[model samples]
Target: MASTRAWILKSRPTGMPDMGNFELREREQEALGEGRVRVENRWLSVDPYMRGRMNDVKSYVPPFEVGKPLEGGAVGKVIESRSPHFKEGDTVFHMYGWRDQAVGPAEKFNKVPPLGVSDEQWLGNLGLTGATAYFGLLRVAAAKEGDTVFVSAAAGAVGSAVVQIAKAKGMTVIGSAGGEEKCAWVREIGADAAIDYKAGPVVKGLMEAAPKGIDVYFDNVGGEHLDAAFATARNNARFAICGMIDAYNGAPQSFRYMARVIAARIQLKGFIYTDYLPEMGDFYRDMGGWVASGQVKSRETIHEGLEATPQAFLDLFTGGNTGKMLVRL
Candidate 1:
């Protein structure tokens, strides 16, 4: 029985997650039970939505228990398996956590294929990020071909996918990113218009880009960005409510955009990715083909070592990573 190094949540974060809320500690590995497999994490994903899980309130996922493993989605290889579904050397994706190793029931994870994607992609494009974008923009927003789609946090994990997926469906995309570099990356990735939300008034910028008004709004960072998206949206537009990074730390009930939904007759849908697992196949099918054919592209910002997971996640809030951010464990 040996100990493993892991990052555990020491307390719930009220706002932006600070390094103090987590502790890098040693804990002995638990014995594998029947049908369980041991895995050494190869890569860990950090996303904007993870902030919501740090609070004590209810969400799509449960809050992390104090002094317990901080939950996260990860890609790992089977170090040992006691089940028929997997074997040593097999790869998998699971909602494990920020640790060097983990053990879960065989049915607790999905087998990761050695497809055209890398471990980073397992935590990114082909993982929850891709799934979020695929289902959120296309299904919830009901984005039709030729629609002008606008997304906030456009250079982020989910937003990047939305831009590409919308383009593939023949929709025009306009994105708002944090800065000039991110704006450039958004435009390079297929957005018809990439506005730097950090530049000036976001609402005015989006209006200049889509003067006729936007048909679809894939919101990732809410607060002021949501306000702007609402102000510029077309009548009867579809607004897909995703992560609200900007509002995640604010005072309760502080941000509101409901009036615009009623005034414009907009169809706004708030979604949690877990609720749409039935559509995962459709997401993988389309994303896999596009990846194989080079019809689409994804970027990964990788940080090495298990010790880096905490710091790597910080970058997600600061707009430090250009695309899907990952930590090589």
Candidate 2:
């Protein structure tokens, strides 16, 4: 019998998580029961949203158990199957990350579509991140052509996608990243302007980037970025509230310009990517065309081996990744 190494939550984090809170253990594979599939994970995703799950609190998703293996998104190839839905060597996407191998019911796995992109691209641009950008910008914010859009964490997985997608739709986009190199990459990926928030106050950078005020805001990093968006929003601007990575680690956030929401008649809506599952076909069709045309680029920061998974996840808070952060096993 084969055994797999997995990372589990050894203790619930109080604020920011550390290596001490996690433990790696080996577990023998169980017998492959009927209607079950075994997979060898190739790429595991490390997202900011996963930070919320580390805390022992209630939210949209359940908190990670103290002693169970941590779970997120992963792309793997089937090594064995007892289910008619899958076969050996089939590539699949499932929510069984933090481990090198996964065995679960067939219903828990979805075969990755052959979209002429690399297998890892499924985790970066064609998976949760891309879907979040697609729904948040188009459906929630209702961003249209000619709109001046502001995106925070513009060099990240979802934010980069939002920048490119907005540009593809003829919207003028301004993006905020932590450093000069990240901001430059944001511009190279189709943002009309890039703000290096580390250089100065975010509100000052945003004001200079879009002097006339922005029509739409796709917020990934909240706190100051959200306040800046409120400060410079044009009349009737729409804001799509995505991940608030700034406050994910128990950081306090103050919004002095929140009064602008009523004064400017701004619309703010929080959304989850799964909420638009019925519109996935449309997301694939549009995002596929943009990617094939060299309009939407997929960028990633990958760590080698499963041992680096915990560090890769921690790097998200420190702005260590320029794009999607993944662990390759």
Which is the leading candidate under lDDT? Answer: 2
The C-alpha stretches of model 2 lying farther than 4 A from their native spots are none
> What is candidate 1's lDDT per residue for 126-242, written digit by digit as tens?
888988898898889999899999999889888999999999999999999988898999999899999897889887898899999999999988777788778887899999998
- Cα displacement (Å) at residue 316, model 1: 1.4
By summed lDDT, the worst window of 10 consecutive residues in model 1 runs over 249-258
Each candidate's root-mean-square deviation in Å? 1.6, 0.7
Off by over 4 Å in 1: 251-258
Clashing pairs in 2: none
Instruction: Give all TM-scores, in the order shown.
Output: 0.96, 0.99
**Residue 241 lDDT (model 2):** 96
Cand. 2 Cα-lDDT: 0.94
lDDT of each: 0.85, 0.94
